[model samples]
Target: MRRADEKDDDHVTELVSRAEQALDELIKDIEALVRLESPSSDLDALRRSADLVTEIGTRYLGVGPERIEIDGRPHLAWRLGDGPRRVIVLAHHDTVWPVGSWGDDPWSLVDGVIRGPGCFDMITGILQAMLGIRLLVEDGVDVDGLTLLVTADEEIGSPTSRALIESEAQGCTAAFVLEASGPGGALKTERKGTSNYFVNVVGRAAHAGLEPEKGVNAGVELAHQVLAINTLGDPDLGTTVTPTVLSAGTTTNTVPAKARISVDVRVRTIDEQQRVDEDFGRLHAVLPGAVLEVEGGPNRPPLQASASQDLFARAQELAAAAGLDALESIAVGGASDGNFTAGVGIPTLDGLGAVGGGAHADDEHVIVDRIPGRTALLAILIKDQLSA
Candidate 1:
């Protein structure tokens, strides 16, 4: 009798072989998507990609997608199947790069790698997902109970779409985020939570040249606050408190009463997040007349291992059966929509996109050869859940 691992590999091989047949068409679809620049903040540009996705979904899945507008930007949701147990396939269509930033031709294929704005970071994932689902649909795989959410503002912290994502994820069996895979194609099972804070200092203004002692220096108070914020970081615990953006003083000669600092906080757990929040709240301005005001907390909760391990185990088993290398999960400091689902106690698996690197960088690209296998893996994973 054959061993279980070998049997699993054979199953994966069959699925991958089927998906590999669609490689050329998948590349074409991905290229088409990358050419359409959909920066997160541009409503018009975002709609262009949104329309393209609608066209593709209608053509391949034989169904139309619902366009939901949040904060004036549109998001896409396509529900497949009618089963009671549903799976949430999470994706984002918007990218960080703005138009005209990638020179004339951002979309290009060279030496087995595809380079383009948002190609590796996500556009490729979206296309791959469509192709994967197409394979399942064509093979008559039962897929009557899945939800695909392609949001428009993920690059800007999902300010408007979080509620929609949470609502859709509610009652779903699991969530699979189409974020790019880790180095060597490892899946992400744990992710840090993101919390943003704005620290504003208010003080009385006076002429710098006259009565300097009477003017309360908000900039100095801000500096003190920055120092205190810096102390909140605990590297061993994977928690970081960074004051990313700073602004102070209206003019050069003025005493400069108002100052604002934007802080980015990443934590590995809710307790750690609470600890940092408490510390930030307890911070007091050093200047006697200066007052400190803090705003924002825990935008995306952490995807802890406790909430995601089961899904990760299942994915690893599926990967092994597919004849791929032994699958392992890693924790990343960056947060994704997966965090939101995992935060709600759902088993979530992430980083199931193309295998490559250079996300959000000038050299952003995805490995051309790896697309077929990854697509097959995702399709099988989705079918596995839907079948159950």
Candidate 2:
């Protein structure tokens, strides 16, 4: 294999060394960040996570409060290596786990696993990107335009942070999302298009025990709609539709007057996005008495990496040079902030954080052993991008 040129060789070696030395501090910072439990709906917790990130940014990242913003939301931005070809790291500090959903204390490193609410969804990602950048700078990789855009609402579709990600991404040439990598080791190059849909069934309520014929039975109608949604799923193409959230009925005796369902959808291609939309529309026809509403249509768009996305290829080379295994970039079923950046026509990579399983579950955790190596890969990726 050909070695990196003189500049590339020295920078890669130096960044790997610095990242190795910084791993302990990175893990500690990640543990503290996970303590905040920044669920997407909890503005306070998300903001607090952002604050914790910014504080760590100040102490270790060498950026001041002026570079940080925390009014209704928390954010941090920095410039590394001057020029037009800029690079940005965009990630959210939020998770799907709700408050009180986990154990009494959700933060701990048990047997090399950092177990917590937001540890897997992305607080760990923030730590990786933040600390990675710090190591990059400390290793003599002078970054004049290395910007980090850490936002609050990625787990719940990034309603508030989407605009910021797009705008920040526009200012850079490429972006990296701090989402967790594959189970062991890999980079995510593509993610399914997403849509969050809702269907409401409206009917007349009557006592099930007394006047059963007088009721329209919204709950029964909802079942029909749910079946229609299930038909949209095609396992062969990675497209899925699940009416995962349902709400209806007030009492056992009375027929449900109103029912609501929220669906989680994933599609492989842009064309399939339209198919999902058409299938969602069929929900209205399923129950004449029901009303349906659709929301959140493909917020991230597919990552869809081609050879044109040279950034991903460059990242692989850099990772290998840092003494890590060659990264196999693959498509993922989950979404990330990288989706937003890529939607805006920028080459983006996701899953650059800790390696672990159980995201959005009570058992969510980060594999402790993978932190340093992943951090090393990130540092090298940044250095390689700046100089590539």
Candidate 3:
């Protein structure tokens, strides 16, 4: 006569063992996806990648996902089980690495470490979701009301898939994001919101050595605006406003008539976003003859910590039951599709993917040994959420 908690622990152990046995299959699937480079900017590569994802998903779940195409890009979705409580799993198949960026060897597994483009960023996460569902079905768990979305354009700000993601997340009990784990496999409980702006200045041009007084000097005005934008960030409050790109003057001697500045903004709260937006709107040209135009605004809202509190707690308990390392949570500065889900007032827990470093860099890789534990943790979390 085992206690309820003990029984739960045994169940988790069984699931973990199952995942361990499937490790080779998981690596094979990851290798296949890594071999096909699907950069966000490449449509043809995205199509091929989507096809491979579909094939792998169908093999695992015994069903094919509905291919949703927007702007010639393919996003895949699957609606599984049926119940009152529902959950949406958010993932993206697109990577930051372009085709041929991996050099000659696209996929490599060395000493239990797999390295390739998109392997850590998200491709492995997509397969992990599929495998988690498969594991649940094999164990005869009633996984009702589970939806998985694999978008094609998340790396490029989800230009084509934001609306669809929101729609899928509506009325869900929880949203689990598989965007890779944080440092040391920690879960991302919160993420900063992102905003982008481009400041364009126009002014009268004149010969610098001759009629300098007749020119408004847009370059000078741009400098003033950059200094003003720098004041918006409050480090204590986790707000950052950075002028990333700047361009002014066409030649060394010419009185430049045009200048542009690209600003990057991140905030931990909606109020900060509003404050920054209002301040940017109030910007005016310092030069009397110069005119300023601001473009772009708040992109993805923040993933507030409150939205993930409950889900993350459950994940920790489930991780312990699964006999894995103690779980930790982090608040990252980067934004993900989880931000959109949390923005819609749904409870979302992110960073439930692979345990690896170098997300978008040349050394991107995944630890082969940790795959089973991570997959098992996801499986148990989903099972518990659905049951609840």
State the lDDT at 297 in candidate 1.
81
Best by TM-score: 3
Query: Which residue segments of model 3 deviate by more than 4 Å?
Result: 82-85
Compared with the true structure, what per-residue lDDT tens digits does model 3 show for residues 159-249?
A: 8999999998888989999999999999999999999999999988899999899998989999999999999999999999999999999
lDDT of 1 by residue, 126-233 (tens): 877887888888877878778889999989899999998998898888888999988888889889999999999998888888777888989999899888899999
Per-residue error for 316 in candidate 2, Å, reads 2.3
What's model 1's overall lDDT? Answer: 0.86
Candidate 2 overall lDDT versus native: 0.73
Ranking by TM-score: 3, 1, 2
Q: Which is better, 1 or 3, measured by TM-score? A: 3
lDDT of each: 0.86, 0.73, 0.91
Mark the regions of model 1 whose C-alpha exceeds 4 Å error after superposition.
1-11
**How does candidate 1 fare on TM-score?**
0.96
Query: Which 10-residue window of candidate 3 scores lowest in summed lDDT?
Result: 78-87
**Model 2: per-residue Cα lDDT at residue 383:** 65
Residue 46, candidate 1: how far off, in angstroms? 0.8
